[model samples]
Target: MQDLVNLKVISLFHSENLVRIPELSSATKLELINLAYCRKLLELPSSLQHLEKLTHLNLRWCKNLRFLPSLYKATSLTTLILSDCSNLFSFPEVSPNVRELQLEGTAIEEIPSSVESLCQLISLSMEDCARLKNLPTSICNLRSLEVLSLNYSPNITTFPEMSRNITELNLQATAIEEVPSSIECLSNLCVLNLARCRRLKSVSTSIHKLKSLRGFYLRDCSRLEIFPEILDTLERLRNLDLSGTALKELPSSMENLIGLRQLRLENCESLVCLPESFHKLKSLWFLYVYGCKNLVIWPDNLFSAIGGASLTGRVEMQKDLHGLSSLKELDLSGTNLENLPTTIKQLTRLQKLILWKCERLKSLPELPPSLIHLDAHDCTSLAEVSSITKLFEQALLCKDKPYTPKTLACLFTNCFLLDQKVVASPGTPKLQMLFGHMFTILKDYHQASPQRNMFTTCFPGSEIPEWFDFKSSGSSINIQLPSEWYYNRHSMENFPGFVVSAVVSFQDYFDDAHFHIRCECHLKSCNGDCPNLSCSFTVWSRRGLHGSRLLGSDHLFLLYHNELVRRFVETQASNKCIYKEASFEFYPGVWERNWSQCISCEVKHCGVHLLSAATDDAEVQPPKRYKYVS
Candidate 1:
């Protein structure tokens, strides 16, 4: 092994004091070097490139690292990773054989023409390089390049000429104005994404010549006015996205795209109507027209071809969308729609329906029973809903009035039936179902809850119910009582298994006069079987405001199951202080697995007392303290 100078790995784990690379020029065998989580390391050795055998190098998550080593001498390097090195400002010169490179979340401003020398490079990514502006024209020399991703490159003005071998290319969120004419030279391209390219205005006409193209995405390009006459040339195209574009109408020639499966025109605000020949797209399965405020109807015969003869008997009008039985997901939210086509009931495959912010929608038409997720928030005109029992997993309904007996079977949390009361059905099935719905709501918006308080009394003071008290013991200490809980169940008969309880304690330790509080939590599940519950407790005690006083201990103590898991006892006075009156809300089925599992608790304090110095100035002498406990 002594004679072997070339090695594959040089892994350094948690070696924080290692400041510079050792003189390894004599060992010509280094290929891969991995420096993982070396926090205190500030810079790299300038002689790192002396190793001609080095190839792969990883410097992931080195937070304090500010610069990269010069790589001009390491001609054998092929792969490099500088991911999450937030302070890195530049890249070293690239060698020809380098194929895979990732520099995500760095300050590199451009891909130097020096990279063009890497003729063997295939996959290259510079994602989240916010300040990057250009790719050198020399990039066209990489004949083997296959996948190139430059997403979130905000300042990028142009792409190097397209490489023929490129199969997948992503230029999302860029400032490119048009697809270069040289882009059509790539005959093997399959997927091309220019989504969110706001400055893009036009596409090269040569796009019609790429016969192998299968998918094209052009979403959020608001200034783009016309689609190049390439629709008829894409014989294998399966997905096409012109969503958020300024297109007013589809070209009559678009009827030739017989193989298209997905069409998205969402937020195409100016599109008022569809062409009649749109029905020719027999392969269309997924369609999104949400936010098309001006759109009034589907093209004639559009649904007839998609639903087949099985749905022909279900609808009388060809303009009705209900006959489209093959359709899977529909997002007609925020349209000027008042009444949905009753024929929509035929789309048994529909899984999701987003009707949020549709203020004018008075009611939902009969929907397929197979629906799984429905979001109908802020529909002011909505009053009642008919049978919706099929979508058991999820349902979000923030209605003004609470009408019961429809789908009250699903457990729900954070169900804001404002000013309305809830009446639950008997048995564990209904209880379980009700809790499922409730749990889902709470988990979704728990972070936004203003109270932020984790623990609270179930019935407040003096209102503890009889179920809480064990009949035999005459005390609530045993008998498998449900811990802290939240519910509207008036009796066991209406008890839905959807709600469960857990216990936890919280307190803040003060040096002399410590303040502490503990409580239990009862949560409602949104869906799925409820689990055995536990509680979240926190104790925070500090010396003084901003932790400036030496009289008090500024330590925090947290325990679960009577075992200490976290301690914040400090020896010296710290400037930062913990929040007071910590509060948080827990998910119905999930409890603290560790000290950090608790959600952020909001502190609300009342009953603040002030001490008087005049009453007993001599008697209130300071007391000597020993070991400080967290």
Candidate 2:
């Protein structure tokens, strides 16, 4: 210990034990002490403060250390580290030179105002101190303090004069409701985070002029209504989010934000419409509108006006919408729409369609042949399966049952609709099966039998079918497509499901390659029937002449009779799936100018597990039948 003093080392902390400075006041040479991560040592000697040269001390991560010494006399100390000192509760007073201090994860609640005496301090990090509720007002005097991170400090609601020289600030998940307008005085400010400040309603109006700010966040302020006008002044802004706000419209001046490259409006449900001028965002590469349920329509010229830009990702719209022919992916299941527009055929790039719980839709229009995915679950009103069969080249059937007779018939007729198979797909085997199924449906099930009518006897509210006498207590109405059994050659569109209904049986010795059967049906009421009355029985037709090389059989079959098939195939193959992935990558940086846009963004993702394999094996002795190689 005598040798330690002669070396001019005032404080020597080796692990847990603090080697005492026996002649510390007399020597006057020792200036610092460090006993960081010392698990075995506990307390410091009270007499050590006499060594006036002692200026630096470190007792960080010492789990067992408890009490601190009185340092009112040692005025030269300049730095202290007590981070993760779990048992530490209080500390002694010292010189104002203590400019750098870290007490993170300690039991300290309120910092003494005397700390403000540290006039030369530059940085202070007190993160993760759950019991810490307030800061000393004296801290405002530290004019040199530039960095302060109170992230996850739920109890802090305000700061005093903290703007002058500080460049970075994070108050994520804090209780701050309003930022004082004086904040605009932060001339050098760059990054700010107020994510999940649920109670924050408005920002200081002068915030728009923070010319030095490059990044800003205001995500999930649920009740926030108006967007601050400060965005107009941020010429360098690159990203913005207003996902979960209550605000319904974007300011017309937003078009002037020329530097913005990413924008998010994920769940602003009150947003019923968008400004037509939004298409003028020439630099925008990504946009999101996933769950704005009340959003009824988009600008009619949305694509044409902005179509030249490289648009990518999920451009979400609410259900029941048939427009947006340029959108690559669509989700329309939760709404109350009965059908999609026939114009949907114009989208030649759609990849996925999700129609879940659309209970009112009884039939689907013909879909784009480009479709690779389709999900129609819980559509309880759907009785005939023919309408949805042509939509997907690959089907994900949720309800487990064999195809109904109607479905088989539609599949047989629409078999010719299959286009070129993807090169990566398995060869010939799937093609053969499709052709064989079509032949079986035409040869064996072509007989028009009313026995198939038993499936549709009861309607909603349990109304009996016409086949049964409703008055008889025991008579039950068989659910069937009510058959007129009597019709003239001219009018056939009067019945529901007429496009797929069995119109006529084969005449004996079928000679003419083409035959037409016209019918007129009469019913007391056309309930649960076609939405349009002028439907006609035009035979299915395909583009160009049907070549025998496309099929093994010499028979020629028409592809799709209704316009639905053409529309479905075109959109299903377009940009929908590809753009959804692009949107995910665009979200991180879009908070520069439009930080309020991502207030309500909630993404709906559907994942499908197409195949699962199970294997079982047992250990076995090798067979001796084969001769060993010599």
| Top candidate by lDDT | 1
On residues 1-630, what C-alpha lDDT tens digit does candidate 2 reach at each position? Answer: 244444444334444554332434454656777777776657777756776777777877777777777666676766777877777776446656666777776776667778777676666766666666767766667777776766666777774457367776777667777877888878777767777777777777677767766667777877678776545546656567777778777776666555555566766777766666565555554465545555555555452111111123223332222333334455554434444554454455455554544454445566654443444433455433333333321122212234322211121221222222322346533233333333223222212211121010001111111111111111111122223321223322221221112211111212112222222222222331221112122222222222111212111111112223222223332321111110001110113233222222211111100000111122011122321111
**Per-candidate TM vs. native?**
0.57, 0.45
Model 2, which residues run further than 4 Å from truth? 5-41, 45-60, 70-79, 90-95, 239-247, 255-258, 261-630
Error of 1 at 540 (Å): 35
| lDDT score of residue 592 within candidate 1 | 29
Candidate 2: lDDT over CA atoms? 0.46
lDDT of 1: 0.53
Q: Residue 130 in candidate 2 has what lDDT?
A: 61
